[model samples]
Target: MNFLIASVSSEPSIDHAPFILSGVLLSLVVIYLASKIGGEISNRLGLPPVLGELLAGVIVGVSALKLLTFPESGSDGSDSVIMWLLQTTLGLPASEVSAVFTQVSDVVLLLSELGVIILLFEIGLESDLKQLLGVGAQAVVVAVIGVVLPFAAGTAGLIFLFGMAPIPAIFAGAALTATSIGITSRVLSELGKLTSKEGQIILGAAVTDDVLGIIVLAIVASLAKTGTVDLGNVIILIISAASFLVGALLLGQLVNKLYVSVATNLKTRGEIITPAFIFAFAMAYLGNAIHLEAILGSFTAGLILDESDERNELQKQVVPVADLLVPIFFVTVGAKTNIGVLNPLIPVNREGLIIAAFLIVVAIVGKVATGLGAFGQPGINRWAIGVGMIPRGEVGLVFAGIGSSSGVLSESLNAAIVIMVIITTFIAPPLLRVAFGISPDLESKELKTEVTKES
Candidate 1:
């Protein structure tokens, strides 16, 4: 026992930890700067802040500045400027370059993963389960159509026209199935339509779409690993997803009571916030253990806790943590985005740009068609609802990131996916206002004008 204890507590990594820590700190600094600057600029321009962060990532990533880049083979890929910077800064020789890259990459990636989980948890806190359930059959239809049309159309189109393989094609298709409730809801609230029939329907459908998208993500991620998608595997995945979701919903209820009780009885510094995160992390781990995405677990935990008495307080606490960590996920995604594939100078770049254009068209059309799926609402703005669903936002980026990191997508497809995400997210807010016959720039300008006059 003593020998094992000593070995476990040994400090073999003590010497190397500083460089890795330094690399992480450096990346965080770049991520925060990129996120804040990009978000602020996007906001100033009447665009989604997430769009700015992504564009900022592109600026700092391998596409341009190369300061926030990742390469498969460290500095030797002649591709990883981030690795080169770290090596130079740490004064490491070629022998330690790979080691530094691997350790730093792992640490940064883990943090990014945690960021997404937290982001999902926050989304759940903001969601209203009763409202979602109340949206009823129209929401269910919209969600189903939104998910099905995009996945089927995108996957089939890529296979038939683009001549892509199955796994990567599936990954790309899965990317299309999500609706960013966070972005959509915010815009609706700004427009004073959040509680309207149209807004409620859109929100409910978006929530359902998020859940479906997560399942699709899990299935595709597995298919990406195995490089095949047989009917049996797919059926098994469906069963697993359904089972996990139902189980998590049920389990969350039981755990919430215990969590609330324990938190209430305690008077510690982290009385509420700490227990909340503990529950969130535990659920995330359980989800991963069951072959699902960890975000789904955290998301479900958020929904469960939304029913608690301390929902508002918990949300207030979670936001700061999300503000701290979520940018890492978004910036890293943007940094990994390699836009060089879309360059028109090279012969092959023409095809990439073409595919990207095709993807953009499909992404817009597939999502917009969901608006037509609304039934029996005599005067409801189906156009606005469809437009609302258009922006894939952070959720779409999650799919793109999965495809990029897993090596399941080709450079062209990954770049295409990123392009599609950027365009869809950028245009949705404006298009949604347009659907209601509001000028794309009117609301933003009117708000600023009013604020200035008031001041």
Candidate 2:
């Protein structure tokens, strides 16, 4: 049986440092086992392995086994079964359980965050910068329409259909506008469509969507907190996000010219890969400091490094690191999700589930229409473009989490948003693969062309 864990913010007992270390390692053991087993199962079933990894997280997480949980999202506790097991095996004192759980979960969360940065960097490395530039205009169109459609549709539907308050309806609508770049990019790379016209449009739009979504988030969150929107802050965010992307790209161009020479002279074991990480991490740090996503910075770093003579070598070396880290990210996103909100057996949950149904419809249809935004691309996979933008993933959760914590959302409304995120994030991968199922020869030719260019 699963347990709902309440959290306390306190320092770990120094005396139980060994027990804390054991807890973290144990959690990682669960994570790795779940990820690999789930991924392999999905691969065998002809679905994206990331899907299996996510489902495996759901199995081990709050929805099923209760083995993996996050207290910061308003659930999980120190006295849960994991803590009990640690106490039984490690002789950890009851007084130290909360601190240990917090420490271990915090470490795991950090690792998950690191995993995504590496994943985005790897994606950036694989992307054709020139191709991405070519589709930049279509991407902007896709991003704006993708955001406006979902936000407008969701907000209106809730207000008209369910009589939800304007503030809460807006927050839920805001959740729909996000596209998970990590998830979409991973699927594209696996499909060998990273260089295809459709793939480029998807990647560009997802990045653009994230920036615009963040701005929308700021506006909604501000609306939730204070009745009036801070026009000034919104303007600053717009300018800051634009400048960061442009500055990072321009700066990376200059820095990368010297980077190849610097790596050539280094004699250490990690000469090439080590310095690449240093650069990626620095950019990631700056991005976070400026309120932009860290993954954005890392992705930019990958794009910059991709231009170097050592690009192939960098890709080869980065894989081992990505293999070690990226699954953690996918798993944790699933693990943190509390799917209990959709329980049909409970009377109170039925209403939220019904609203979730509406949100889900809007989320899927609104994003699918975004494929049409890629205008003038003859014979392109419009459905694939739409599917690529479908998964709200972590970005949607961020919106739901903020809305819930800030008291702007009712219990039913919050539950509906979470369910919308879970479903959209889960369904998009397989749908994307199927959408790209044109004639086998043509698809294979596209892959071959991209491979030749990358090689």
What are the TM-scores, per candidate, against the unseen true structure? 0.90, 0.77
lDDT tens digits by residue: candidate 1, 54-164: 899889877788667676312342355666676677775566666776777788878888998998888887778777678789888999999999899999988899898
Work out candidate 2's RMSD over C-alphas.
7.9
What's the true lDDT of residue 309 in model 1? Answer: 81
Report the number of the highest-TM-score candidate.
Answer: 1
Residue 43 displacement (Å), model 1: 1.3
Model 1, runs deviating above 4 Å: 1-14, 73-90, 438-455
TM-score between candidate 1 and the true structure: 0.90
Query: What C-alpha lDDT values do all the predictions have?
Result: 0.83, 0.79
lDDT of 1: 0.83
